[model samples]
Target: MGKEFIELFEQWADHYDETVTGHDLEYKEVFRHYEAILAEVAKRTFGHVIEFGPGTGNLTEELLKRGRTVTAFEPSPAMRNLAQEKIGNRAEIKEGDFLSFEFKKSVQSIVSSYAFHHLTDKEKAEAIAAYGNILESGGKIVFADTMYESVEAYKQAIKDASEKGFHNLAEDLEREYYTTIPILKEMLEANHFTVSFEKMNDFVWIMEALKK
Candidate 1:
């Protein structure tokens, strides 16, 4: 799975930020929201921040600018190369997916921008629990990603996409599992983390949770 996306993203590394910014409907207006989440984390800790899928270093650059060191879980070679070029020594770039990646040490905060949607439902829960294991007490998590309101809403979205002649897009959505804020809140709370949510738009949300 990681190998396949790595090869696919290797081709997109150069133009990722530009193309995804305007072309991806679910991602439109997400940059500002990401910055807000980063700022929230910045207010909490000055320690290293763990980031999953730091593609092209858009959010990585922001975290570095705020003086937060980043440990990136990025699997794409080309993407990692570009991110390194953009971020320099400000980040620790590790090439792997979140499911297999482990923290070498405790970090005060964990963040992912538009990356969590890549995980399946079961994987997402595991990842959330793993996040708790890696963080110190009161450690913060700021996740900004494309999310549906519910599984049912995702189903309706697919139906609407199909009706609008986006058959291929509908199929893609069916294959990938995204999340809703409420469901994410439940998962976090079940892991003993307190949670809150802020929306960027209809699909993008900033989910903030703190480890208890």
Candidate 2:
């Protein structure tokens, strides 16, 4: 699962909002158009939704605004607390990760933002497979996160970040499980999902996968 990064998220909980708002220079490009990205994901989601790594609940808020019922999971206690405080009782925010969660209701969509990179490629595939089992035909998975077009692009990103004196960003790019689009496309298709992607920023892309 993605719970391995829970400690980082716990320490980042308080300042996560600030980072997404472009206040952090190193991550500014990574979180560019943050609000718009959330809105776009929310717009594409429908009916009962399962949201992974809700973080501070920014996307959850967007989904609620659109009248979508949301069931969210977060591995970090600090992040989960902030999300609950921000969202109140409107949606349930549980202690879970992408590969470990419980849901009984019929879910029409799954949504997440800036959080999936914590899982390695194999784990990502596992999570998608689980979603494939959980959702019916026509169910959707909308996720906005940092993904590259190719392996070269991913390496160049780390290099570019380093040249820009963004050591932290470069290290994060190297440390995290950030992957390329082709691999994700293959995983989605293997799980019987027809997927499309749209660029959201220099470092972010929106993956909209529909169960087939």
Candidate 3:
């Protein structure tokens, strides 16, 4: 399922920007919010950072802007091209999926945005485990993604997307599986991550987990 989704993203990467205008604002805010989060996380750990599933280098650009070295792993070729064109010589962009990608050295920080919900429940659990394996002791992972405040809110998002002709939006809503703060905390905790969650907005949830 994860592989198939990665393939779909590869196919959609070229048209992704046009397909989702909301991503522009979401990406921008991700950077602004991430700065503070990264600072707090970095204060406790040190090493090269790896960003999983960086789409088009939005967060990568901001991470570089803050004077942090990052290795961005993106599975989509089109996204990698766009990120390379956007980032230039700023950061190392690797073309690969987060679930299976290997690292030569342990990283201090592992971050992701708006990509985790694309994974199945099983894959999400596996990815969290993999992150634990790759992160050095005391390292952190900060992730931001959609979380439903209520089932009604999830329904409304689907309805809104339906009105916009994106009938498949419901599939993107992972509320049925892992959309609430508790679920996210439980998953991270099960993987030996000390979790803290902040509700950023009606739909977005920011999670910071330190390996303990």
Candidate 4:
């Protein structure tokens, strides 16, 4: 499933900006909310930031604007190319999966938006462990992604999509793996992260955890 999503994203890379720009008003609002979160993270950790799953450099550009050194990682080749074009020498864009990517150096912060939920539950747990291993002490991990109110809510979302003629579209879209805030908090805490969350509207949630 991860490989399939990578392929789909590669095909969508060329038209990603156009397809997303103002196409979904709700999603656009989500991005704006994400930008605000990025600003806060930038002010708190202004050096040596690493961003995972920077599909097309949207948030990467924002981090660079704040004068932070950014390492942007995206798995899809086409998406990485587009990000490199947009960011140029200001940012280092690399092609690698966040779940498996390694860095020789530690970073002051790691940020991801609308991307981490694609990982399986085990993968998500592993990612938190990886972040713990790579992050400098007192560094932060800020992430925004889909969060379900309950297990039933997730099931309803799946049912709603199927009934609205979106089953196929949803299937083709990135598969989301969601967990409640408590579950996420437990995972982060187990990994030695102090976690907090802010619900941004109904569809998205922003979580910030500082390494202790």
Best-fitting candidate, scored by TM-score: 2
* Model 4 residue 212 CA deviation in Å: 0.7
Off by over 4 Å in 4: 24-44, 162-174
Candidate 4 minimal-lDDT segment of 10 residues: 22-31
**Ranking 1 against 3 by TM-score, winner:** 1
Per TM-score, what order, best first? 2, 4, 1, 3
Query: What is the per-residue lDDT of model 1 for residues 52-149, given as tens digits with 9 covering 90 to 100?
Result: 88888877877777788778889888888888888888777887877878667988888877677777767889988988888999888888777877
Error of 4 at 16 (Å): 2.0
Model 2 segments more than 4 A misplaced: none
Segments of candidate 3 deviating more than 4 angstroms? 15-46, 149-156, 159-171, 174-178
Ranking by lDDT: 2, 4, 1, 3
- Per-model TM against the reference: 0.84, 0.98, 0.77, 0.86
List clashing residue pairs in candidate 1.
none
In the range 1-212, model 4's lDDT, one tens digit per residue, is 15547877888798777645635442454444555665665565556998988888888888888888988778888988898899888988876776867588988899887777777777888889998998999989988777776777767766765666665434633355667777788889999999998777455677899999
Q: Candidate 2, residues 1-212: lDDT per residue as tens digits?
A: 46667778888999999999989999998888999999999999889999999999999999999999899998998999999999999999999989999887668999889889999999999999999988878999999999999999999999999999999999999999999999999999998999999999999999999999
Report the number of the highest-lDDT candidate.
Answer: 2
User: For every candidate structure, what is the RMSD over all alpha carbons to the true structure, in angstroms?
Assistant: 2.9, 0.8, 4.3, 2.7
User: What's the lDDT for residue 82 in model 2?
Assistant: 95
